[model samples]
Target: MPEEIASRRSRITPEREAELHEAVLDLLREVGYEALTMDAVAARTKSSKATLYRQWGSKPELVARALRCTKPASLREIDTGTLRGDFHRMVELSDNAQMAKDTALLRGLAHAVHASPELHQALRRLLMEPEISGLDEILRRAVERGEIAPDCPAIRFVPHMLIGAFIALPLMEDRSVDQAFLAAFMDSVVFPALGV
Candidate 1:
């Protein structure tokens, strides 16, 4: 095939790309990243393996794209005007209910990251960096508002503390982080420690 003809034929529309990405997430949720094959994704999305390979280049790339697609857009914009409020929102947003469907997906990803250096790097770049950027923006806004001191140690640890509970408690207690837990965490732990 001519280069131009091949290029034209390979061009995937944005909607199609989104559909494929959604299919990938669904497969991730169902079977997990380790078991999720490009052939399965193509079959689920009604596309071909050639199309998936053409678009994402590799399984890691496809998994990265799928993981990125599942992230809530609300994570990017969390401005509740107060540090406490922002922390609460972050906890609520990171709750187990939101992540309940992805337990297998996360486990699979954890395994993949442990086994493959390149996939680990790609996963960090694609999944973690954006979330860190969003959390940094939230913390910066809190500092600007004077809700927390510019040099507060809590500021540095807040994201990890909040997200850690979500990731840990579910495994330990087998329960979701509810509003009551969020409120108590903020009142007893976060606010008190931050001196807010």
Candidate 2:
């Protein structure tokens, strides 16, 4: 379990906490972070504001908990031996079909993170840093396997490239990351750039 989960489990019943967290996610999707209030979450979860306050302490912390709960666990560990296998696993894990359903929730999170420095820092620590570390582990393994040079520019930039592709394509063209695109990305950009 994540450290956050272990810490939070001691504070509330598991079922009740799940219900409250789900309510927060629902509200984030429907009303967005800016409009979602502790009172609304309390009413939705049939809990009191005091309960929320006693558990989460603040709106950003509650939102962070909701995001933490909702994120898919598939990307937690992916070590496929070879670089290509690892890259493919990463792409498969980041399926556009899965993400499409959560576009509203993602937008709400972006808005909230942009508006608050504290929330932004929390997001960096909770979401971005861990994912980046996972990717870096894959790259390190690739380096050990002799698939790429130790100092390869592509290895260094791979995480940003992959995430940039995800963010840019959706925001710019409003298109999903299809298999054809993934193939081309791997063939033309990723592999060659990595000197594979």
Candidate 3:
């Protein structure tokens, strides 16, 4: 087969792309990962199936890109002169209205993630890495400020612990992760574990 032409192409505006991502997340919350067909997304967004494929190549790629875009990119700007203040800001992050939909989407995608290698990698790359990296940055700052030890083992898994609390609280406690709960967790669990 001959190579396709590379120069002449159309593009989507950032605003339109964001709208498509919002549609993807909303659909994922409603129909879930396994049942979320490209056809359905095309219909929901009033977009051509060919356009989606040409943009994302696959469902996993598209979903991953959408999830990645939902996370806050300004976390590096969260320094408040103290770890407590920083964590309080982190607590406030869970207060968004879409958090409920995001939680539902995550719960629905759980089973599919295990069954689909492509989707599993996509979620890890798009959804998890940035958050983990931000948390690591926080840990590094704490170490530099002597608020926590550089070699603290808990530092490595703080994100996991936070995620565990986020997931488990909804299941075991029948409540969403919120600012107050996270503040308590930080004071009682995370800060103590860090010996801060």
How high is each candidate's TM-score?
Answer: 0.80, 0.84, 0.87
- Which tens-of-lDDT digit does each residue in 37-153 have in candidate 2? 989998998888987886777888778777777666635488878988877876666556656655546765786778889888777777778888887888888899888899886
User: Candidate 2: misplaced stretches above 4 Å?
Assistant: 1-8, 13-15, 178-180
Q: Give the range where candidate 3 is weakest over 10 consecutive residues by summed lDDT.
A: 1-10
The CA-based lDDT of model 3 is what? 0.80
Q: Which stretches of candidate 3 lie over 4 Å from their true place?
A: 1-10, 72-74
Residue 146 of model 2: what lDDT? 88
What C-alpha lDDT do the candidate models reach, one value each? 0.75, 0.77, 0.80
Candidate numbers sorted by lDDT from highest down: 3, 2, 1
lDDT, model 1, position 18: 80
lDDT of 3 at 25: 86
Comparing 1 and 2 on lDDT, the stronger one: 2
